[model samples]
Target chain A: MPRLSADQRHCVRLTLNGRAVEGEAEPRMLLTDFLRHVIGATGTHVGCEHGVCGACTIEIDGALARACLTLAVQADGTSVRTVEGLAPEPGRLSVLQAAFRRHHALQCGFCTPGILMSLDHYLRSHPLPTETDVREFLGGHLCRCTGYVPIIAAALDAAERLRNGETDA
Target chain B: MKPARFDYVRADSLAEVHDVLAAECGEAAVIAGGQSLVPLLSMRMARPKVVLDIMRIPELAGISLDGDTIRVGAAVRQAELLAWSQLKARQPLLALTLPWVGHAQTRARGTVCGSVALADPSAEIPLTLLALRGEVELSTKAGRRRVAAEDFFQGLMSTARADDELIEAIRFPCGRPGEGHAFREFARRHGDFAIVACAAVADGKGVRLAVGGVADRPVARTFAGLGGSMLGQALDAFAHELEAREDLHATAAYRRELVRQLGRQVIEEARRCRA
Candidate 1:
């Protein structure tokens, strides 16, 4: 067997936020680091490098996963969606984002991007989710600020708007 | 933290995995979901020379029903199994325990066989496998063999599987009629590992109880014609048999108490459902 140097980088090509992107990273580089550094999508926050914190959440091949725990090389040929893709246009908030603002869902805003991305995918499938459903879904995410009250309110409000066929606020 | 530098080999088939493992013998690690392995790698706990990526192996992915057994492939993600309606209908205990495995994000990438392969004492998958009397299929270049769940799990982070072999699938027997099953665990948070967990299945004939997180490996006890009141006493006696040890999260005595309490609750719940 042949051995590769620790600094040797591999080429990774994938679709990010609907556009085809290519970058170079070591086999050991985490997907979170690759996205923020190589792809310049810093919106995805990295909390615990382990799988515990939901701060590094992203959609890989239409499934939610922890970017921190996933290797960049393993994501080759996959489609990824980060928090940067949530809004329709620059400087404009999506309906869910606007609801977060209206409901004052975030305080420090570190966990906001991951939460928004998670709920963006979640609300699409669960348009008429109940309070318990919303709470249970929120269990995966951790919000140190605002006591999660406003976050739940914002998620519920966004679900209502999305159900009413409102994509943009 | 980033993982240590290692060669990455993407195995498109089982043969390729075996070839790589044979060549790199004792130096290569097979990665399916990378949920558990990646964490261990990042922490420098596992520093293999080569990582054989089995996620792309088409043969190692899928969920199928063969007769009375539900076959779950090694690459079948935890969330995928949770979404399979047939699995939920066939094995209600597994369905109840899957949600408690981890958060939605982790489950999206964590594999069922990977969890069983890791054999975490507190993991829901292993405990449920024990409770359901499942069987794990392990394959090497020589051949494939099936091991019962009870004999498969050795101890904390240990299994009967050889390092050169890969887990193919796990077969779970379908739930029988008139059987009532319940799974209950006490965890600090919704997704955290349980301090002590109980999985119980009761029928008119008898009851089977499996407990995890309070022992080195999941332990089971079968009772025939045991009444509800006697079930509690049996669990109390069984609690003393566990070699529960103190960890940062809990003490041995606390875990024993948990087993006794949760054991009775799950047994009663299963009995009520049976009735």
Candidate 2:
């Protein structure tokens, strides 16, 4: 009902990674910036601020979305999950992360966080993914290194591991 | 890449939205899903004094079957529509094209009406709307009106919609007997914007083919009772008439060739699927 002005910051509250967090952001501030600068959750990286690159992907209310394409003011009161939530606990990795490590899916690791977020969401709905399906799904992401071969291998291995109830790493 | 400063308003009701739009007139921009607008904003291509949010309004959500047509509300997300169990049975063309609209990540948040409202020449949603001859329900301070898809899309990123108007919902007709719908797009990447996208509706009378991404707007032509060679010549004429220009991604000759080849292939597929 009330319009939040541009000169002042508005209070935005949302649950992040199973915990409630609050921050103040301008209406023009992107959700990616708010997550990193305001919420201090740097695990969600920013690449190609116009949403072409998938480096800023995250789970918004259980749905995969581009953080660069969402306004922080719009994310208010929503539950969000970043790459930080992927690990089961401190110093531990999820099944997908372990598979990526074993297969060397990432190099330089600039685009790893967003890739991990997307693969994590996809593998849940599609427990059994063929090589073609994995390849097509990875079209949303761009990774200069690994040539996408090892990433595809890692994704399939992670899917099989999850199917076998392998949860911790 | 931050957007310029603007005041944000989240409306809870249609009356509130009307008030805000009536007061601001043409200086406000409506936000829904934000798949396209956000990118433009980040690039500083689109700037407005006020950004209005309509997703909170109860009147702007839900999907319902109204007799022979399926009505998708303005706030209905693309993923929700793609997941609808009755989609294939009701609007098979939409079912075939929704997956091509964007990636799973973007589709999870983008709205159906939002796609039509943006009127992207290379987008799947508007192309499907035109292919099926569907309509979008427009709302403004003056009242509600329905505009046919053909007239709704004017030119490159232009539409008949007014600055103060909002696309309330989009109506897609249900699939009928003896009719088959097929969609094909040739993009460099699966989820990228199309270089040439074609959708064909084949029925008893003739086949209506709609082509996108090669022109400033999606265009459709009906070829009735044409033989193989005649159809090929007609397709060639349509391709040449579009006058597709050269862009960094493709050449004019290459695009016309895709239109000629992909268009004929899609038409055949639609005819084969016709019951």
The number of the candidate with the highest lDDT is: 2
lDDT of 2 by residue, B1-275 (tens): 88998999999988888878888977888899999889888888888889999999898999999999999999999999999999999988999999998898899999999988888888999999899999989888789999999999998888988877888999988888998888899998899999889999999888999998988889998889677899999999999998685798899899999989998988888888995
lDDT of 1 at B122: 90
Candidate 2, B155: how far from true, in Å? 0.7
Error of 1 at B208 (Å): 0.9
Q: What is the CAPRI rating of model 2's predicted complex?
A: high
* lDDT of residue A6 for candidate 1: 49
Tens-digit lDDT track of model 1 for B1-275: 87888888787888888777777777898888888998999999999888878888889889999899999998899999999978768988888899998888789899999999889899889998999899999998989999999999999889999877889999988988899999899988788889998999899978788999988888888778677678677877899989997899999999999988998888878888877
Runs in model 2 lying further than 4 Å from the true structure? none
Give the Cα error of residue B177 in candidate 1, in Å.
Answer: 1.5
* Candidate 1 ranges with C-alpha deviation above 4 Å: A1-7
**lDDT tens digits, residues A29-84, model 2?**
99999999999999999989877789999999999999999999999999999999
Predicted complexes: DockQ each: 0.57, 0.88
iRMS, candidate 1, in Å: value is 2.9
Extract clashing residue pairs from model 1: none
Candidate 2 positional error at B130, Å = 0.3
